[model samples]
Target chain A: MIITSKKAIMFVLSKIEGAVLMAKRGMLIVLSGPSGVGKGTVRKALFEDPEVDFNYSISMTTRNPREGEKNGVDYYFVSKEQFEENIKNGEMLEYAKYVDNYYGTPLNYVNEQLNAGHDVFLEVEVNGALQVRANCPDGVFIFLTPPDIKELRSRLVGRGTDDLEVINKRIQKASKEIRMMQNYDYAIVNDKIKNAVEQIKDIVKSERLKVNRVMPDYLDSLGDEI
Target chain B: MIITSKKAIMFVLSKIEGAVLMAKRGMLIVLSGPSGVGKGTVRKALFEDPEVDFNYSISMTTRNPREGEKNGVDYYFVSKEQFEENIKNGEMLEYAKYVDNYYGTPLNYVNEQLNAGHDVFLEVEVNGALQVRANCPDGVFIFLTPPDIKELRSRLVGRGTDDLEVINKRIQKASKEIRMMQNYDYAIVNDKIKNAVEQIKDIVKSERLKVNRVMPDYLDSLGDEI
Candidate 1:
């Protein structure tokens, strides 16, 4: 009877040790880039990976849903009245209007996801990304660019849908975006999808090793013993 | 005769290829830290592997050399007049006066070693590191730190060389330096010598892979083909 009770105690201690080892909080990664720079492709690759315990925060908007879009899954799809109310009530972190429609990020969902110990990624335009930084200064920012101006123009044209004038306008806009690249913490040149994704993964993995963010509190809680 | 001539051409091509593959450039890595952070131990371990091509850049001083010190190798041992003249002529990148003596980094030797493709390291105080940053903005800056305040004071007292009052003074000074930690580009906590050295090595290797610095101008020189 005594031997069995000792074995049960040992088993409980082992389980407790394992749980302690696994306790680690998640991070917030904010990815920003000019349009057509392949942020979506890289993000898609990350989403497909199982080892990463992270999720992209689906942004909420007041705009009408497009075909095949499901409410709360694709987006919250709130009415303009509700959205404006949330904005006034300080529920929206940042919001902007485009094409006569309102789009904004609901803060409650992001905070809930972060609290649940899952890293959240926000994929937004440069303006929205700047707003996120202003609100959450600790967020990591990554900027992406193409190999060169010619390649960027070629990629835009190769899409085969945009007219020549639209492509030219996009190219001009991209040039202006490139000028602001220096303000970013890190600039990734997306010459190849696979390599670019790998580089970004390395950055995120290495950032997790940063000393300041890694919890010294846990060590302190270990008390006078290891 | 024709066979011999072909063999000679092959040999020349192989030699040129080897030279291209072996081409390496030196870097200046400045390591700064708060007092009692164990940077010295990590630096010693780094030099243990001679193939790293790492050389510590010794600062020249106007102070009298200690017994058995070599003139150029240990320090430049410049006269006070020469040191002040170098400062006037912008030869000294950064300098400080202490105890009626002067210490400064000589610009010529550092650049000469860098041009010869050897990576130089400056183990300096935070103030000196900041000066280096201002003068040579491209050089890498690494700040070493302790795992926590408790560990830092423990290490300081564990040395057994300083009195209690002196240790307390150092602890106060260290906290001040730790507050300036964010000024550095990278900070590695010196928890253990081997771990810290590995972290530093990772940082150096990754910094070397920066795309903009490594992107050869030969691509542009190759004209529109790129």
Candidate 2:
């Protein structure tokens, strides 16, 4: 007996979505870690595992694509002017100025997957991840840590690149990030790749069953809305 | 070196306990639902599943021994005077009077088990469960609900004793409790017993890995406190 506009209907639907178990949006899982902490390795293992259903957010970077790097897939290779325009227009979720280039997560693709009930993963810096938390408070922020700084240092050196100065700088940044780990929702110790991935998987699965995700339709359908 | 009293050391230890995961106190899991919600059946199944490590709390009551009920195992049968004394002494964590008999949970036993690293389960009324929450804020509160109210009604009637009046009273109480499901940390649909048990187990396992539970020793040992 109620008539409403499409927008009003969508508004009501979202409210119902909050209470009901019907098709809900996918979770936003943000992953942040120190340099040389194996974020890339953990992410690769996660992608290879068929059990987890998630899409990695392809970030927009102003830097030129290195050899073998594909545009739009590996990175959303963008012009410095275009990246700045997106920032000026309030499109970038979070952006940072690196050594020379700018890197940021675009708003659209992440939200697109989330709207389709697909979980999205973003490997972000702590500052950018905190910004995403402000923009999307419901997102889960997981801080991935190495077994130890020695391992992180060795891994950085193990890459067989980056001189002593760069390695020390990376180590310093890692220490600062590690101190802020308390602000994150979950911390994963990356001593064992399988264990870390398993912990993250369990966290996601358990999060889906939180009371906030209850479907009001199911409850209302349970014999006269009791 | 700074010298401190045993009391000071205890206080410091408790403070460290909050920050580090040295020897964690076992989790306190509170389970509650309506009369026909199959709480007992589900609990039995969970206990039988050797994968879970938990012990059921023994509640104190003023009622006399009913047939084969053991003194300590079934319920700690106490007189009205003794029960009143414990309540006055603040020993009862939570209690309620039903049919002119007092039923309560003693604080010491549950804490003892938690300190010893054994999870404890307490099945109580919604009111009592909330009281337990106030006392043990860190405890995980799980609300067990039936698939639907009609099933609950049928199950109550299936007991073959409760007349129409009592069944209606119980149903009404359950409806009120269901509306308060928002306060709980988790709401599990009791369609399949195994599935319910599995979900609870997963929640406990995930909780242990929370960022707040990081062991200081592990972090300190991680190659120069980074």
Candidate 3:
């Protein structure tokens, strides 16, 4: 019996040591939502919350940015050649082309922020979120939607930027996106921006307490004691 | 152009109405963790805090009541015949036999608490938690573990109830439980009980603001005429 107790204690000590090592590693949070679901509004509100230190990720784009858009701030505008080079080098987490312009997430800024122990938020399309998940298996993925399909259509049309034809196309695209909601770790319906922001904020704040993210040492210590 | 704007307004209005309906539903939250990870300690702390109005669920069992165990206080002790009847009637969420005695969750009390707009916590085994999840898919699940396996084993052994053999058995069971941590909605490593309690409190506070849980009529008015 004494020997067994000693063995148990030794086993516990080794596990605790491993957990302490893992505590230093960072965790990633990914937010994805359908278009025109006020994801931007929610993000803005979240960033404004003083309690959270969030690192905003600027995307790399080959397209010409609009007026008052800075190279690094608005987007890391690069030449098509540079963009293609980064893609070949696997420096981008995910990339897509739109109207002959390429946009992608550059891995550097995100990694830097995560290493600094600050949570990073990525506002991306559904496809981009999925790609991030594939690359970073540990990332927390949240999918946002309007309360219902009817409301989603109205949000898209209410923007007044799209013509009827464009609006219809968006509605169809949203239908497809809504079906993918189950793939997310959590779903936040954009029925109320304030409420949705609170939900996302809660998810972010709660995620920090995850054993893998903040307490590997804690878990390891839960075993036998040396 | 005017027609396009009008259509958009109508769409937004309807979306808000739908959100209001979904908000009327009560939300469920499930709290689970390994034994001796201080889940009970954290829960008591949360209850003491004014912000948490959570109802604690007392399970029903067929085991004879021990001294000082009052009906509906510690548990609702029922005869084996009554428990079997409950099982036949689908009145229990989950049931299992331990040491030849049956323990199960009664659905009535849980539903009553939930319908009264209170978040009910069923401190049950993983099997029971799973059954609750199956019954209520929208319920949020939280799993707790110790900061390290060593700490957990220490806590278990420190209780002084079990000898080396019993402690070893618990340790083996815990290893299996750790593997199932991924099935949880959130994993909380209990290093400091106060800190862990705060984290869980934050989650409950934030989850209350979910779009589906909070009414959204105000949002529809954002785009409507005064």
Candidate 4:
């Protein structure tokens, strides 16, 4: 009995010690939202949140970015042929064509950030997010939408750049986009920007603690000590 | 182009309106830990926390109540025959015998609270927890361990009711329990009581937002408006 007690004590000590040495894997957070949902503003606020560490995934686009866009920072500018080759090699998480330009997530960069223990955030369109969903089902998929259609309409009208006709068109597209929330891992109603950012941050904290992410090596060390 | 945009807008509007009427299901949170880990203290703090809504699962036991213990509050005290009948009826989520006492969780109470939209918290042994795990895979399983084995030993010794031999026995059982933390959904190092409560509260917030929990009725209601 005494010997058994000693063995148990040693076993407990090893688990605590082993946990301290084990590295944590980063979470893959994929976000999608309709226009006027303030993705840019929310991303900025998330970056500033004190408790979170985020690594934004830069997409590779075949289309030239408008003014003030820098290559490799705003996006990794690549040729159409190169993009096609990546598609063939299964190197893209998700890709879509809009107005004759190609935009998609490069798997290598995302994998690198995740492997290096940095939470990678990718804000993509609905269709693109779905593709990423297929590739990384474990990834946290968050959908941001307005509280109601009236609020959405108000935001679109408030944008000022779009005319009444154009604003109407955008709102209609947004309605269709909102339905995709069912496919997301989480849906945040962006009624208040600060609350929305905090909600996402809270999600990051919880995902980091999932049991599936527990290190096998650390668990094995417990038995070794016994 | 105009017609397509209008149709898309109507489709989106209907989906959002549908979502407004759907009711959300409650979460099932299963918690387990080693002895002297302060489960009682943490549960008390969690109950008082303003942001969380918890329904603590009342366990059933075939043991006589100690001084000041009340039926239906501390435990649902039942006869050994009654407890065996419950086991025969498959009404228990988990049950185990210890020192001539039978203790376990009753599934009916847990399910009633869950269906009523209250997050239920269950504190059970590691083996009991695994039984619940098989019965309810969607349940969130959390484990609480001490900051170190030394602190655990000190707590067990400080109880004063147990002698060295009893304390040693308790510690030995605790080591086996600590190893079971590997199977838990999240493990909290309970160095401080308040922090443990907050961690659990954060977990509740995150779990409520999972995509699988979104209300289909609410999603359908949005389309009704269109």
Across all candidates, the chain A TM-score values are 0.73, 0.75, 0.75, 0.75
Provide the lowest-lDDT 10-residue window in model 2 chain A: A1-10
**Poorest lDDT segment (10 consecutive residues) of candidate 3 chain B:** B217-226
User: Who is ahead in TM-score, 3 or 4?
Assistant: 4
Please give, as one word, the docking class of candidate 1. Answer: incorrect
Query: How many angstroms is residue B205 displaced in model 3 relative to the true structure, after the best TM-score fit?
Result: 6.5
Q: What digit string (tens of lDDT, one per residue) describes model 3 on residues B5-124?
A: 666656656655654555344567777776666766777676777876778778899999999989998799999999999999999977888888889889888787777666787666
How high a TM-score does candidate 1 get? Answer: 0.59
lDDT of 2 by residue, B1-226 (tens): 1233334433434554444443557888888776677887888788889888788898899998999999998789999999999999999989999999999899889989998878898888777888999988888888887554445665765664766557667767766667667768878888999999988887777776667655343354343422
RMSD of each: 12.0, 8.6, 6.9, 6.8
List the candidates' TM-scores in order.
Answer: 0.59, 0.74, 0.66, 0.72
Candidate 1 stretches with Cα past 4 Å from truth are A1-28, A47-55, A61-85, A97-103, A112-120, A150-173, A180-183, A201-226, B1-29, B34-36, B44-90, B95-104, B109-121, B134-140, B152-185, B197-226
Off by over 4 Å in 4: A1-24, A34-36, A62-73, A76-93, A146-179, A223-226, B1-23, B34-37, B67-72, B77-92, B145-183, B215-217, B222-226
Candidate 1 CA-lDDT value:
0.68
User: Each model's DockQ?
Assistant: 0.05, 0.27, 0.26, 0.24
Model 2's DockQ score: 0.27
**What are the Cα lDDT values of the candidates?**
0.68, 0.76, 0.72, 0.76
Residue pairs clashing in model 2 are A19-A216, A20-A215, A20-A216, A21-A215
